[model samples]
Target: MKKIIIGTLSAMILFSGCSNFLKEDPTDFVAPVNYYKTEKEVFSALAGVYDILGNRAAYGRYLFFEMDMSDQCYMALSSTGQDIALYNYDIGDQKLVDTWSILYQGINRANMLLERIDQSDISETLRDNYKGEALFLRAYYYFLLTSNWGSVPLRLQSTKTPGEVDMKPAKLKDIYAQIIVDMTSAADLVGDVTAYKNAGRVSKSTVWGILARVNLKMAGAPLRDKSRYAEAKKWAEKVINLGYHTLNPDYTQVFKNHAQKVYDTKESIWEVEFSYMSGSQYEEGNVGSINGIGTSNKLVGYSYGAQKIMKPYYDSFGVGDLRRDWNINDYYYENEPATGRIVYAGNAAAIFYNRSASKWRREYEITPQKSVNTTTINFPLLRYADVLLMFAEADNMSPEGRSSQAEWCVNQVRQRGFGNLLPGAVPTANVDLPTGLDVVDFQEAIQKERSFELGFEGLRRHDLIRWGIFLQTMQGLKSYKASAAADYQYGFRTAENIKPRDTLFAVPRSEMVVNKLMEQNSGW
Candidate 1:
């Protein structure tokens, strides 16, 4: 699924050098004066817009480990200095600044491409697809911004110079409205999943699935736009009715495909592709190394095993549910003799809280001589299972109430979780969610189901925040950890440090300095 365009596009950015810093454009070095002249150049520019998804500040690191350290997991080994996981970060925190800057860079790249792509003489079909992708990506970037920062500067046009950086913030609802508009238009313009045959590119299914997610966010806390629930269900049903995607039968194989740099489009609808080794060098991500099971031996993939699954999340899995062991490792790798052999703990209560998130184990990586700090595993952005769950959740939230269709959707996911994939295979009674749950009970079921299926995939934080349970969930962890053994008390630091303002991260000081019209979020 990893494309060759990444190398060419990055090289284009690097080689677009300037002799005089004062005279050259500062917003982006890949100047339009000499670029976007041909069809291939336009494609390369589109790849540049996609490249930011793998930047170190996004899915490459902070997204899965740093920003997403919610009630499900915590960093086992703290970094040398300040860390965002504990929620002690301020406006000047470099992690926040890098993430904010990287997202804007992506938006700017898409803006530049969209602004110039119409001049190209490419085939009408291809040009429209590229335009659609750029529009969707620009909106997706804003989704990340408003979802995290509340209100933000909605820059539709590319910035030309340093003087163009002082735009004021747009209200959160306005930004969401633009997201819906851009995504809705992109859905009509983009090709279908069969056309792309991979999750790396934007397709009709990708746009609709994500639109469901965006509307669900609006329907939940903060926005409280209940009408959007029906809209979310409408988009999610579109993806389902398209009949191009389904569960991959084996749940673990879904992630194993990512770990081994393979694409399974049936399960993974969209992904941020991270690659390794073009010719002599590598471009990788800190997926397995930082978040996988710990091992000092490079041969087994040197991992700090930074993240530990919270014991409560570990225990949330029901008996005979297969996802528990696959997601939360029940063992560690010994560093002795550099072979990094496993040391099984058998899901013992003593070590429950110490288990690593093993969804992206480096042992599955086929590349030779894995890097000490990075791997080629891709990060999934949207999956079919997620779409099914979203549809169910939205249907339950709609005035129609919980329907049999919603129950069936949740059952399909739960049955797969219990390893019942074949049509004739009987779903384990204990594993399947009970039928005819009331509105509130069914909603709670969807919440736990999402955590069980999508934990440690860089989504738990946003899920908690949108559901209005972020602070309560963190505080719940504090009480849960308080009852644990003394050694486990260290896990409660996140809850202790969290404040109501922690719901929205502070605007980066760098942006505040330049955009004088921007006001800080509540409580700095």
Candidate 2:
């Protein structure tokens, strides 16, 4: 069983710079100085840091909705107004306020934990581990902030009074520098994967994987720092060489494992844990409800049908790619047992609207009934397959473009997707990379591989943005959706409406109104 970290911080540290609308006065709150006297108290504090992952505003909702803005999926016509605004790139919309608030809340918890843990009388190893976990989490939150908003205010220390709060945005480069420093220190202090009792917690491999992603972002688009390309490759390679993780061979089993609350630590590096059994609505994860096919679709018994996969993206998969069959379900099983009796729901046009994000299928969920929207399925934050793809992309960007190592890394992912096809066997069904591609072509191939392999996983938008093709790709998608013949139609976005400033989200209007130092991104 996965060790579920559950704890509540005694005091909620409000962002004091913001007005009364944003601040919540503490009640019966034990201050950190008064609380961190015992080892259990310090561990409970660390659990408080992990608790942020279960917040609806953070990974549970906003993060998944942001994926709709990418080319991978579209918000269904029945989706919430806020989701529509987000998908349409309405920069001034207040939809992202929760995301901004919750992330800062997490950072505050981490800061408080780091501040108090040092004074505790815990064993040296225990202290180091807790410190490492806090540092990694802090860096992770900062990464999410910097990547989404570009220049968010840096708050390393816990805010004791309203006077100490700084609302000024820091440079992205400086934020990234801190991220690297924290993660590097985290990797050193944290125990190896084997040392960790559970897969849910951070390990040495987790730090390496995150560092690879961070370095890759620094090397791409806005930064264009070529030096980081080599660093990115180094980190990804380190994770691969560690031998603690490997591909899960069967792609379909991965999600099934998630639905059953089974942890395949080999492929899943780290996952955000959720449980409907927890009895608190905040603890439930709802990705399936938001994206699954609705009962109105005459297929699934229950679902919100809020988001559907875009036709263009679904069609982009190769002819025999197992991911297409696994990720996108054109049909639903008739009976409760789901005995492979596939009933074709509709033709291409009809299925487009009803197309289910089958990755998180409700049928696979081990709940008492199918009607329950809340699921215990953990959302994968990082996986070994992602690491392999990162390695390939980073290596291709390095001086050795189409190096043998790059080829091997890319092939490993491809091979796994192809059901671990034997060497020298003709992969006619699951197509492999064509031989003798140049650096440019190999890079393009890697991009396509990631798209096909990692679609609908909330990574597409960031990937496109870092590749410097987000705007152009969305522009093309708008035109493609506009011209496509589908049974159900909704207004598609236009290229002319998307400004370069739309790349970074607007600082929440509520936040901007209260803080004089807060600045909105340009054209917002």
Candidate 3:
């Protein structure tokens, strides 16, 4: 909040000031050589770090739900927003540039805080934990960067002077190694995961979840090797055995926008914080209510009322899958502005061709977008289902590889939807699952399930790339541009014409030109 408004740029002066959430405008005035000498000031600075994690630019929209563009789901788009992501991202376009900037800005702010904290004298317990969190955050952002950009400059300390920022990019391999280290250390310092909030507060599970992901990514294609898979499985299992998390009884329980923040759900291990308060006086929206079916209009802005589900994925659900029935709805209403009457609507059925995505539907006021307390950024990082699958994936990756464990993992996830998917467990007499499936087949099945299970949670893209299916699954959406131009307001080109450099984004042109030591990622 408060930038250390130091005019002399000297350290060690203990100044006094009120602890308000200060705007950190860099281009501000000069201050006398006084400094923050109290513990309250330190706590305020720590809150600023958590606030950064909750910020809309960083995790609110982009991290929560924006990236679900594979054949499994679609977003109804026309000019302004949703359409562009669906079409442009199919071939990996400029959105990657936007992602790079947002993530780095978040990283830089967190680093600045960590630097400030290191320079201050705070309680050993709180200070060490906070420091660990800052490290985890930096590593978190870097993992997001390398996952998308391949190689990026790793900035640790806050650059006080202009010249201090002259830095070169680090190799992707090196970036990942550091990510593993930070998270591994973070897991050590963090306390027990007694509840989701405790985990939400950046505890052991959060770090372990991240480590599992980092390890899994390293062991997958593009960086292909299975060395880290067992480690990945181990970390995931550690989080699982903590006994604090479980899946929501119904698939929809964990996602209720206005529902009380219950920490009992088995599926959710970590979720980002967003609070709902009236007017712009506070941040956070009742995401469920905002997207509720009753609110024909919205508090912040109408999300264009899109829970667009693609036909192939809709059809992919087995008849008995509980997720299918629980996850979607078919109605939205609009207020007749002039007459003050209400109107209900569904997709142009012929075009959608299958059940549309139901995850976004709920009831509330509509027509004129309403403004009220809303919580739009409630994002989840881990859930129990993932742990089950992770355990299965790890078991499959073990030396001598147990195929049964992989089968159980896939079945646990499936049983929730289809019910009793044990050995010889089939949804219906006609629905045939392959007999005695092996590890590779089960691995792919889990990947597909994770895609659908965690779709639109800002995770599907990375998962697809790890599965080596990014190009394959997304390719279908390119053809959609031709058929959906008027609707989505965007079109696409053939995959052959698309360049591979698009896979790893350009290090925002600004970053590259400013930092002479920074070289662009290869093929960028």
Q: Judged by lDDT, which candidate is best?
A: 1
Writing each residue's lDDT as its tens digit, candidate 1 over 1-524 gives: 01112113344343111111111112244446567767767776777677777777887888788888899887777644356888877678898988898888788878888888888888889899999999999999899888888899888887666577677899889999999999999998898888864578889999999999999999987999999999999999999998878898889899889877677887898887766554312357787888888788777787887888788988899887889988988667666455555666454545876678889888788675577877777789999999999999999987866778888889889889988885577767766677667898999999999998998888889999999999999887876864556776677778788889988888988888877788899997
Please estimate how well model 1 matches the true structure, expressed as its whole-model Cα lDDT: 0.80
TM-score of 2: 0.88
Q: Cα-based RMSD of the predictions, in order?
A: 5.4, 5.9, 6.4
How do all the candidates rank in terms of TM-score, highest first?
A: 1, 2, 3
* Residue 464 lDDT, candidate 1, scale 0-100: 94
CA lDDT, every prediction? Answer: 0.80, 0.70, 0.55
Find the candidate with the highest TM-score and give its number.
1
lDDT of 1 at 330: 65
The parts of candidate 2 lying over 4 Å away from their true place are: 1-28, 77-94, 296-301, 333-342, 345-347, 368-371, 421-430, 482-487, 494-497
Q: Where does candidate 1 clash, by residue pair? A: none
lDDT of 3 by residue, 205-275 (tens): 77887788888889875787688898888888777677766555456655553134445434666666554
Worst 10 residues of 3 by lDDT: 11-20
lDDT of 2 by residue, 12-90 (tens): 4322111111113333556556776677677666776676665666667567654335766666653444442344444
Single out the weakest 10-residue window by summed lDDT for candidate 1. 15-24
